[model samples]
Each structure stands twice: as C-alpha cells, then as structure tokens.
Target: MAMDGKARSAKAALKRQAMKEVELRHTVRYGIKQMLGDLMHWNKISEMGEALQLLILNAVPESALLYRNADIPLMPAEMIRHHARQGIQDRLDDLAGQMFGASHKHVIELLILCAHDAGPEGSAKHLRIPRHEITINENVSRKLDQARIREELRMGRDD
Candidate 1:
C-alpha cells in the first residue's frame, strides 16, 4: 500500500509537469504569433506607402519636382496637408474592408505623409488626372506600362 501511494504521487507530479510545459508552449506560440502579426502589419503599411508615393510622384511631376528640390512653398504645403488628411480619411473608411485592426491607423498616417502631393493633379477630381500628365517621367511611364502588361498576363493566366 505504501508503494502504491508513492507511485500515485509520482504520476500526479508528472501530470503537473506536463501541464506546465503545455502552458509554456502555448504562451511562447502566442508571443511569436503576436510579433509576426505586428511585423506583417508594418510590412503592409510600408508597401502601401511605397505604392502611394510612386503613384503621387508619377501623377504630379511638379509636386515631385518641388519635393526633390526641397523648395515646396507655403501654398503647396497647405494643399499637400489637405490631401494627406483626405487620404487618412479614405484609409479609415476602407480599414474594415482591409481587415485591419486598431493599430493600422498609425500606419495609414505614415502612408499619408509619404504619399502627399500638392500639384495641379491633386486639385483635380478623383480619378480625373490626365494620363499624359501622370506619365511625365518616361521611366515611370515604361514601368507603369510594364505593370499593366503583367497584370493583364496574370488575369489571362487566371482564365
């Protein structure tokens, strides 16, 4: 009987140790998942900002020139600020569709700053910027054409 009691106590101790290990594993996995989530969120925001900047630079050569020259006047700055605010608002509205959580607001703000411009195109109606004006840079125009071709190829592949 004494031996049996000792064996039972040992079995219970082993079970407790197993439970503790399982808990530790779960905690570690949770931490890793959270870190990955944050990293992915940051990457998405960075990519969006890059794409937006490319769009803005390609859309408004005058604004891009001002930025490149670091000679943006007060009027241009105000217009850029207004566009940035609008971009933020648009991002917020589309957040739910993008499956982004609360932390994404900061990311959107960062993207807005990188993509803001204040040229004639900025004042134009949405989606109304002339393709000729938007494609002022020959290199950017070639790249845009290539991208369109690639997109078309992808769509064809899907079919």
Candidate 2:
C-alpha cells in the first residue's frame, strides 16, 4: 500500500511538471504554429482545409485558377484518422503549404476570384462579384494567340 501511494504521488508530480513545461512553451507567441496537437484539434483544422478545398473545386469554370491550385483532394475523415495512426498526419498543414504557405488571405483571394469568374460562367449562381472589364492589349492578345497555336501544334504532333 505504501509503495502504491508513493508511485501515485510521483506520477502526479511528473504530470504537473510536464504541464508547467507546456505553459512555459505556449508563453512565447510563435507565428502560425501548425504542429500536431490532440487528435480533435488536428482534425478540426484538417476538416476546414479539406472542406474549403472541396467547395472551391466544386465551384465554377472547372479549370479555374483556384481549382488548379487546390490540387490536393480531401480524404474522408475515417481515412485521415487511419493515416494519423500510421504517423502520416498534418494534411491541413500540407494543404496550407501548397496553398501559398497556408495564408488565409490567399485562400480568400482565390475564392473571390472563383466567385468573380463563376458569376458569368454559370457554375455558381448565388455567389457574385462585380465583373471587371479586362481589356487585353494587342501585344498580349497576339502572344496569347501564338501560345494557343503552339499548343495546338504540339497536340497535333502528339497525335
């Protein structure tokens, strides 16, 4: 009985010491710390990133810039949990790294761009942004045409 009591007190002391260390670590305001936390916390960030990526991919132009930039497909939560068990977590951080270093501003910009492009393209109806009239200069238009022709020629050669 005495030994058990001693062991319990030792364990309690160790836990308190560890918690003190955690408190000290969090005292410094580090920028954008995405390291692994508890499972629920990690899942929350992962789900948000995955959900945004899914929504962006589903909306507009199909070949829009956001769709292109949102290259990583979101996996089901069960699959993510399974992968986490295997030490392959942090899909959210990976998604952020791919999406211009995980800057929320960039993600919002892409979403806004999608909204602007999709308004007329008829992919997303509810979202609307003021369509800015873009005038392509003659030089830019010619260069774009040349690139299109070169791509066609390459495709023909491939065939």
Candidate 3:
C-alpha cells in the first residue's frame, strides 16, 4: 500500500526515477526559469520587490503564483541590500516543490527580450493572411473514434 492509501504499483515507477546532483540542479534551475517565464508571460511580476516576496512567502503553488491583486508587499529598504543573496538559494531549490511550487534572472531576461524583439514573429505587424488556401480538411485530422459506438443497431450512413 502507498502512503496515500493508494495501492503501490508493482512496477513502482517512482523507485526507478532518481536525479543526479547535476541533473537535479539543472532541473531545479530550469523549473525556476519556467516559473519566471510563466509569470512574465502573464505580466504578474515586475520588480525585485515582487520576486523577493514571492520566493520568500512560498505562495507559488504548482509552479505558478496565485495572483492576489495589489497584495505584493514591498521589500523594506533594509532588505533591498541583499536582493540577490545566496541565502535564498535553498528556497530556489524547491521554488517549485515536487508537490507545490523565480527570480531576478528570468524576469530580467524577458524584460530585455520583449523590449528589444518583436512579437513571436520576427516582426510585430499582425499577419493579415487569409485562411482560404489552407487546404487541411478538419475531418481528415479529426479523431479516429469520432463516430461513436451507437447501439448495435445498423443505421444508414449519413455520408
């Protein structure tokens, strides 16, 4: 039996999955990167003050921060001295916990990237291309089981 009352799987996938220190560090850093990316994409966090609050408070659940409007507490003038301190490295390790879940880095990169680059495309001009010549038929791409298993009755084919 599993700790959660669920029966343990005979294969025990968790037992086989172990991350080395290098791989684990990379995974954690990547998760941190993605966490900040997720926030920047939605434009929630802007400054170090916000980043400090989010990281310290553990409000980031599931690798994403739950936005509480205008609730971002400002870092006091005293705390600003160690904005990117090493002490918080431990917090960044589990920034996105296995169960629950940025920083000064990813947000800074995005702020610069968005400022310099165009939208997703090389240029920002909206694509006004018409969709007529796009000849991919929707039906061809639909699910193979689109036709449900109706009652075993032999119905005439609508097609």
Candidate 4:
C-alpha cells in the first residue's frame, strides 16, 4: 500500500511539473504575440504595455537584447548607459531573432526614438515604408472597451 501511495505521489508531482511547463509555454507565446503587436502598433496592442516596458526598463535578458539590437546603429553611449543594466545576460538570442527577423534592432531603435521625440502631431513617423495611415474603428474600440471591462471584472473575482 505504501509503494502504491508513493507511485501516486510521483505521478501527481509529474503532472504538476507538466502543468507548470504548459503555463510557461502559454505565457511565453502570449508575450511574443503581444510583443509583435506592440512593435507593429497593431490590433489591441495599444492596450498592452509589457513589451514596451521591458524595452524601456532594459530588463529583457541579455541574449534577447543583443539579438534585438543586432546590426542597428548603436544607441548613443549615454543612452545605453542610462537605459541598460549590467548583469548576467542569458543566451536566448534565437528568441528575438526568430520572432523579430532582421529588422528587429531597427524597430527597437525607432521605438526608442519615438519615445524621446517631442514633436507636434505630424512631425514624426513610424519606421515603416509606404507609410500607411492609422485609423481606429469605433466599433472595434467599443468591443475592446467591453472586453477590458469584462477582464477587469473577472480579475476582481479571481483576486
């Protein structure tokens, strides 16, 4: 009976470990999707800030940072010193590369520039060529607002 109980305990432990891995995978996937939207300034991205905050905080792992910064004009040394932290950098370079492609660095640079730019409405532009005009659909905006409210309510209940 003890041996059977031990087997059940081990099985339960494995199940918990698997659940944790699944959750991690889901979070990573969701983060990447949101990051892509943030970079592109597309679809519900305006409501999210995690990716931008990570960049602003310079808190992405070093591997992802180096990958994101590849082949781009270096940020001013002062900006780098002020923005980035010195610590153990990880080796997740492939994550940025795979998710962002070759222009990842340039995109990040443009984002930083936009953040610092203090100009009148028409003074600056996003980094994309053949500049497409951005228009928010009112219907979509209403739906997003409703969704946000529902999410807040759900979160309140969970808490």
Q: Give the best candidate by TM-score.
A: 2
- CA RMSD of all predictions: 22.3, 20.2, 15.7, 17.0
lDDT per residue for candidate 4 within 77-99, as digits (tens), equals 22111111121112123323544
For model 3 the TM-score comes to 0.20
Question: Clash pairs of candidate 1?
Answer: none
Q: Which ten-residue region of model 3 has the weakest summed lDDT?
A: 19-28
List runs of model 1 lying over 4 Å from the truth. 1-135
Answer with 1 or 4, whichever has the higher lDDT: 4
Over all chains combined, what TM-score does candidate 4 have?
A: 0.20
Error of 1 at 126 (Å): 24
Candidate 2 residues 88-114, lDDT tens each? 123333444656474433333344344
Model 3, span 50-157: residue lDDT tens: 444344443223323322122322332111212333434455545534223244333232232332233334212211222356565777555433544342233645
In model 2, where do residues sit more than 4 Å from their true spots? 1-94, 125-159
lDDT of 4: 0.39
The number of residue pairs in model 2 that clash at the backbone is 0
Q: lDDT of all predictions, in order shown?
A: 0.37, 0.39, 0.34, 0.39
